[model samples]
Target: MRPVGCHNEVMTTEIAIIGAGIAGLSAASELAEHRGTGEGILVVEAERDAAIHTSSRSAQQLIPSYGPEPVLELTRWSIARLLEAGNYLAAPLAWPSSFVVAGSPEDVAAMTVPGLRTLEGAELFELCPELRVNPQRFRTAAVDESAVRTDGTALVAWHRERALAAGVEIRTNSRVTGARRAGDLWELTLGAAPPKTVRAATVVNAAGAWADEVGALFGAAPQGLRPLRRTAALVTLAEPMPPEHPMVDDAAEDWYYRPDAAGAMISLGEAEPSEPCDAQPHEGAVAGLIAMIERETSLRITGVVKAWTGLRTERPSDVPVCGWDPVAPGMFWLAGQGGYGFQTSSALARAAAELVLRGEVGDWLSPATRDALAPDGSPDQSATPR
Candidate 1:
């Protein structure tokens, strides 16, 4: 209801979020929680619907101890919220699922994390009898009983609902084409038929793969965000897989498989760099995953029921980039979550909101984590590629 510009086709708000994906929706929900009464908030999305990209295509696993220390910390911070998401969701969002990691003796010996229990060759077979690696190749395994399967679609919907309930306006099919800074606000031009404009005091670039492009519209420098393609396929096995079978992953081989209904879902854990676009699964990648699974497991994957690909945008450090742009005032970066977006959504959203509202990292994030995920920090490109 507040109008800052004179044009009739122009709308104004205190904060404008430039994506409807899980990250944007989560940040909008948190910002709504801390916003003052009557303060306007708007979410602009180019897709016809929310969560139509990486959000819905995620593996949807909540593994708190999976990523780097900063990401693990964020995942740890999000566990409570994910567990309590039933209050906001129409149905329960997460279900307990076992996570098992396997590798050679040396590989397993180097793999250490808090609360992970080591398992011997027999123990691994006992846990997942269908696993078919040669006894000699199977050295050791670790189990994280705390892992859970998350409903990615339901979680995004829950966040959208919460943001809407807090009076945040969401405009779909509205793409932002350009942006410029006015006296004290950002003026955004949308790719609408009538060319509508939006004026806001602050803008949060949660555009996932297109985060850097969105920032460039407002003269912000790119943070070297790289969108990578990850391919997955669902295969129907000759025999029914146990519903309670734990999700098994070979860290050294970079492949994982888990039970899905009558079959299993598998991925090669490939992270090939790609341009920002609607991703498509490469037949070779799908076939490669199937081949690896057949070699590593006893299950005969007769046919593929379905296959898909999603983009997981990674930063230079392979950690999420969340915070205000160091060079651009009123512009915030909330992209580069890679594959950990769903697991770390709550904590990252809270941190983004705190940074936008107070211009500082919140207490939930430690000083070390703050430095690692800072938008201004220079990433070491010479390090080994992720």
Candidate 2:
């Protein structure tokens, strides 16, 4: 077992994961668990630590009905797994009421899912007192009571520790600058002072926003992954919202806000296309969200104490890209998760481990789901979005 910060002068492994975010760490942990030895596995991160990007910047809510059909399947499965107290995550999952408010009944109907139900008047106002002032603005609303509030920080730490305990070597600050397929193996050049090289039998591209870039180094065709910047802010309210208040998705999903310890966390919810980099909050986007919160709810914004942003990478299908690359034999695609990364991590990781170790996915996932997640750019055959 190699400690997280330790790295050998000369390195070679059977499998190498190209990102230390939740997707990479979780997949590493699962692969280590089933393989029974992590000595052959290595996790490489460009950053000094793991989960310093989108993994830590997510809103951290697990809503099964909040994504495309393929993503919904994974999210539902992940939620079910996480709910089995103390089974998946070390800390307990928080059950929080999640509300989706719309300006019309048609919009509300458009978002209907398996566990969502209509809410109005007193019941709705009781759950979100701030919405009482602008009830007319929100003509209809639906609630998913099973929504779980996850701890992204805890999730990252847990997966990192688990992978390390299983003897997986995690090398931070080791960026793959060059990748060449050599017969049955891949020769990866790390961007170091001396340009260290490592050879691996398999490579997993889980580089979040930079997945396509990493794939190109190995001659793998681009997956058309678009990195979108999402901005959010923490506002100090004139009066603190009740802790029991449900997280609200208002303005036809253009903006949303959830209760935070300081006051509230509001997001613009706009997916602005951007290049891969450390994203900073757009002042105009944060201002736009704050203004909307004032107009749509009773919560008064006194000051915005904090503002931050993250990049959510999406493929053409808007569903996560998994499975082995059709062109690159030993290369696997595990990126393009977008905003549903945290909610869908566990299910995706399990399926990825199965695919990598067994060369095929079992029946744990539906045939349609497996096809939708394939890396060949095939059309998704999953159920139509509700």
Q: What is the TM-score of each candidate against the true structure?
A: 0.91, 0.92
Maximum-TM-score candidate: 2
> On a 0 to 100 scale, what is the lDDT of residue 115 in model 2?
52
Clashes of 1: 0
Please provide, for model 1 over 160-231, each residue's C-alpha lDDT reduced to its tens digit, 9 standing for 90 to 100: 888898899999999999998888899999987667999999899999999999988987758899999988
CA shift of 227, model 1, Å? 0.7
For every model shown, the clashing-pair count is: 0, 0
Least well predicted 10-residue stretch by lDDT in candidate 2: 377-386
Q: What does the lDDT come to for candidate 1?
A: 0.83
- Pairs that collide in candidate 1 are none
Show model 1 residue runs off by greater than 4 Å. Answer: 1-8, 36-39, 87-90, 109-115, 377-386
